[model samples]
Target: MTGRTADPGLIGLLGFVIATLTAQLEHLGVQNESPVFWIGAVFGGVVQVTAGMLAYFQGDDFHFLVYNAFGWYWICMPGFLLGGELGFFEVAGPARGVFSLMFAILALGFAFPASMHNSVLPVTLLCVSGGLGLQAAGAFTGVELLGTVGAVLLLAASALAAYLLAEKFVWRTMRRRVVPLGRPWIAGDPDRES
Candidate 1:
């Protein structure tokens, strides 16, 4: 426990950002219908899911573990985006909604587990997943207002994390005086003890 363990929070943060983006894209009417969005979703999903699996094995109550597990949304979202972006899959809107719905389910399901271990990591991830779900619903349903909220959540989570990390590790120089010993405490030899 004293040694360093991989930060699962990164995966959580990834899921958060992606989820937020998913919501934002939905509002923008560019979610599954856009190739760029799909690319981002797929790439992000693979990273998150893989990280989550690793965390599961570590079995530490690190917050990152929860985030990674909930990241499966990455895989689902990209499928919708790809369908819309590629034109071969014409059910982009419905697909996005489906994935977004799935995100909500997964996010909620993992919430308690994360909270039971690490509060901040799980809370942030929850916010992100919720945002994604809202955005996806709005975008697919043509609700622009919900998209804006999603964007805000995304920005907020990122800003908060950055601030937390910066605050957590403050660099300071400590001045110390070096004391030199000219000779050993038991100077001449063992016979001196007598």
Candidate 2:
């Protein structure tokens, strides 16, 4: 099927990974400090790289595809690379916090785009937003406050898309309503007959 089709299972799986990682990262130990960071980095990096590559092959307008593919490659891949760097280890917390904002912008910017083409982008945006918001709250406020908000937003978007898809495919209901463009008319009134 085309990428445009609904993929609820995939969305659910990704959401699960995102939510679990977000939860695990909250209780940081020496061994497990930033587990969500690593998971997110890998998941995000691989996805961007893969999707970007696919976009390249699409051979549509080079500008948009190149922008999308390269943007992902630069943002997602580098977060992982920079996090793994030696200098980054010294200030891992601050570093991840700062760099996470960049990811937030990218994810949010693409959210509308994703919602337009596929259900994946919308969910991914919610996951990334939630995960990053958690990191940010933890960074600035010493509390993990945004996870619930993120999860809800992601879940809501998913439910909405699912509802739309169900209404479209299963129920086979009308997707739109168009009112006629004309003046109102009165029935059985002789003056309004014309």
Candidate 3:
């Protein structure tokens, strides 16, 4: 049997949306903190990292990096916070801002390359960057409004990621594009049909 593996993007995006939405909800006070960290560590961290490895095996360099990097982000954030609160070490408020800003930069780094692929991913990355930026701002200023808006942005990113997952996997069995994922922002033929 010489068949290929299923698309890792499906699981990756599934995990992405799950973690993003859950975290956003928790941030917005719609959920409790207890489940959020565990979800982030398991689905967002471990699962995404595993998916990224699968993507690498499939020769998808971009998705591979996206999944693993964000996966580690999910893992480390909770780990650091928990470690700090558990007396393992101290966590400074300023360090949170710097940490978030760093990831925001990293998310922005993928914007252009993602733009070359499809409209959704670049926009998704932009929302992720915006969310992280706002989160950083909130962390620095201690203003809840910034974080609230950031969580909203993350929710939007989650929705977009879900749509992308459907376009890639769910309706993929169809001959035509059942769930459209708009044109690439920077493709060779923007007007050309796929």
Candidate 4:
């Protein structure tokens, strides 16, 4: 099960792009909410997890951690929504604010490590962090504008992720480096400055 395969990062990034765009569009009121659940559950959750597993076996620990964490995040979202909808547990605005803030912090933490890979990864992670922060602010302050801004940021992040996927998978398959992600900031070791 481990001969070789297309870079798992491509699959994970594609899944993230599709799911994030769908959820953000719903938040922006451009689409119905129903589709978001399925997209998050299947594409974001399952597909990303699969990619993470592949990365793990391929010895790409960074991608494995990033993809797995985000995949689980997406997978658990439906459960949280269901809990609120079914009245299993009350999720007040402040609670949701706290949750979003925590996730934002987590994304920021990952961004530092992601920066070692390439410019695009760090930028993508920063967008995700910023979007989550906006969402938190919106929930906490009851401001619709903040949420709208967050959705816009998420949409932008999704576009970036899609481009990365295309660059990594499609162009590479064609034997060209069409979209360069830029040089890694950390050079040899991800933990040490170069």
Candidate 5:
């Protein structure tokens, strides 16, 4: 497999940060859900999924899996909400819990493995998984606070992702790491930055 290309990781991180932050802001009542719908469909869906494909072409299987999974998540989840709002379909009550539970499971599965790479990946995954888990709890119990905490966790994840993207940009221009990505949970090669 080819391992040559402009970094798709940057694209994936950028999309992840934008979409997650926007969605979290909306979840916290700071932004309108309508604009978030577009952000999710385009930046979250198209850009991240395309980045996943690029990672696949680069022989980076882990990124291919992560970015694509979350890309589809952004697309499907937002579309489902938008569709419900438009009266196309209504998934309310316990059914919503079921749907959230499924995604929460997936996100949790990704979280631990992400620790092998860097603090960033694991932190992002754990935050997202925690957010989804809380969302599921919110749906099941009718507690808005659960969802609110979930939104805060998601915002934290987005902030971490944005830091990663900034780190890349600084490295590109300075030929040095100006913004550091913290150590991986599992130690890696001493020579490698991440």
Candidate 6:
């Protein structure tokens, strides 16, 4: 017990922001090809998983679950893509829709609890959930418009997550609440002392 607090949320959020933004760019056709595999594997998968483990050791259950879940999502996404590319299996459009839907549901499920934490958290989760839902719908219907919407939403979510990361890690570390995260939605929250 070093009595030291580990700020794994920062790293995890950073990983999420980068990977998500990269993917969104590809979806928007701003990038011709996705280099998401390596980025997701390293930053999203490895870094986030490490953050999850550290969060667990630090006794932050919320962060532990969030980080780990997203970490696995990042890790497995590449595997699925690679498998399809390698002809090991086919990744049909409907299958991709199902995959996106699953994560969208997961994000929504997590958003409720996150709402109790802080204003920024729930907002970020909601944006991400909405984006994922749009992506699922697009894949299912083979609609380009829905995918475009999803890409925009993902970009918004990434921006919000980046703000949260800066607030939590940078400003807080400097003992300056430079960015206001707003009040927690849950009234009379014990975690926050006003």
**Arranged by TM-score, best first:** 6, 3, 4, 5, 1, 2
lDDT of 3 by residue, 55-116 (tens): 89977788899999999998986786587768786665878889889988989998878887
Q: Candidates' lDDT values, in order?
A: 0.52, 0.43, 0.84, 0.83, 0.82, 0.83
- Candidate 5 lDDT, 1-194, residue by residue in tens: 25535778888989999999888899899978887889998899888999999989977777898899989988886777787898787767777778777877887888666766667777777888888889889989999999999889889889988887888767655667777667778765444332
Q: Which scores higher on lDDT, 3 or 5?
A: 3
Stretches of candidate 1 off by over 4 Å are: 1-5, 11-43, 60-70, 160-194
TM-score of each: 0.59, 0.45, 0.91, 0.90, 0.89, 0.92
Per residue, candidate 6 scores C-alpha lDDT tens digits across 1-194 of: 26657578888999999988887888898873347777878787898899999989977788888899889888877776677778887676888889888888989888887877778888888888999999999999999899899889889989999998888775546767777888788764556311
Off by over 4 Å in 4: 1-3, 189-194
Number of clashing residue pairs in every model?
Answer: 5, 0, 0, 0, 0, 0
Error of 3 at 2 (Å): 6.1
Q: Which one is best on TM-score?
A: 6
Give the C-alpha miss distance for residue 36 in model 2, angstroms: 6.3
Over 4 Å off, model 6: 188-194
| Model 2 Cα lDDT, one tens digit per residue, 49-112 | 4444454454323223423533353345345545576456354555556765665666566555
lDDT of 6: 0.83
- Give me the displacement of residue 58 in model 3, in angstroms: 1.6
**lDDT tens digits, residue span 59-174, model 4:** 88878888898898888776667677789976668888898888889889988887787788788888999999999999999999998998898888899898888777755467
Q: Name the best candidate (by lDDT).
A: 3
Candidate 2 has its poorest 10 consecutive residues by lDDT at 185-194
lDDT of 4: 0.83
Name the lDDT of candidate 1. 0.52
* Residue 125 of model 5, lDDT score: 79
